[model samples]
Target: MVNAFFLFILAGLAEIGGGYLVWLWLREARPLWYGILGGIILVLYGIIPTLQKFPNFGRTYAAYGGIFIFLAVIWGWGIDKKIPDTYDWIGVAVCMVGVSIMLWAPRH
Candidate 1:
């Protein structure tokens, strides 16, 4: 369970960080290397989730969507120095609640 959450965090970082890099390159006029590296990281992001022990692709991805949202807020706050307002925290909380229901709820 710990490992699963760790994987989610790593995968989120790869995707968001990679996208941020590409955003910088194209939108902010950074050098080409940023885009190249971002693309590579995006490719790697495609592969990381497969390492999860969970076998259900849809469930895994659905749960990951929630984790990704939470991580994105943290990433923005730390990297961009943009503090999250009340709505951001509430949204993150809602996302995690949805994730818990999807990933950890008891089922017959």
Candidate 2:
């Protein structure tokens, strides 16, 4: 459970960091060093924890990827001034349902 919490936090931070880079890159920004640094930091944060601790890499990743997509949509609408339409909401719902199944399905 603790690991799951950390994973989600890392995922959100990564999304925010990558989103900042996208915003900067779109503005014809200078000093591109920040982009590389931020990207590496985000990727490392998201990858290291799970790679180091998770027992089932594929299942962990599949579940987190779905949750990441859902959260990205929320962040996009809330912080990026992008309004999500019905299709976006539907996609998020579907992904979240899949995430729940992936994470909770019992193995016998």
Highest lDDT: give the candidate number: 1
RMSD list, candidates in order:
0.8, 2.7
In candidate 1 the C-alpha lDDT for residue 106 amounts to 88
Q: Could you tell me which 10 consecutive residues in candidate 2 have the lowest summed lDDT?
A: 45-54
Q: Model 2 off-target regions past 4 Å?
A: 2-6, 48-54
User: Which lDDT tens digits does candidate 2 get at residues 2-91?
Assistant: 677567657766767675775676575846776777677677656655643557878777777777787788778887889999999999
Model 1 CA deviation exceeding 4 Å by range: none
- The lowest-lDDT stretch of 10 consecutive residues in candidate 1 is 99-108
lDDT of 1 by residue, 1-108 (tens): 899999999999999999999999999999999999999999999999999998799999999999999999999999999999999999999999999998888878
TM-score of each: 0.96, 0.75
Clashing pairs in 2: none
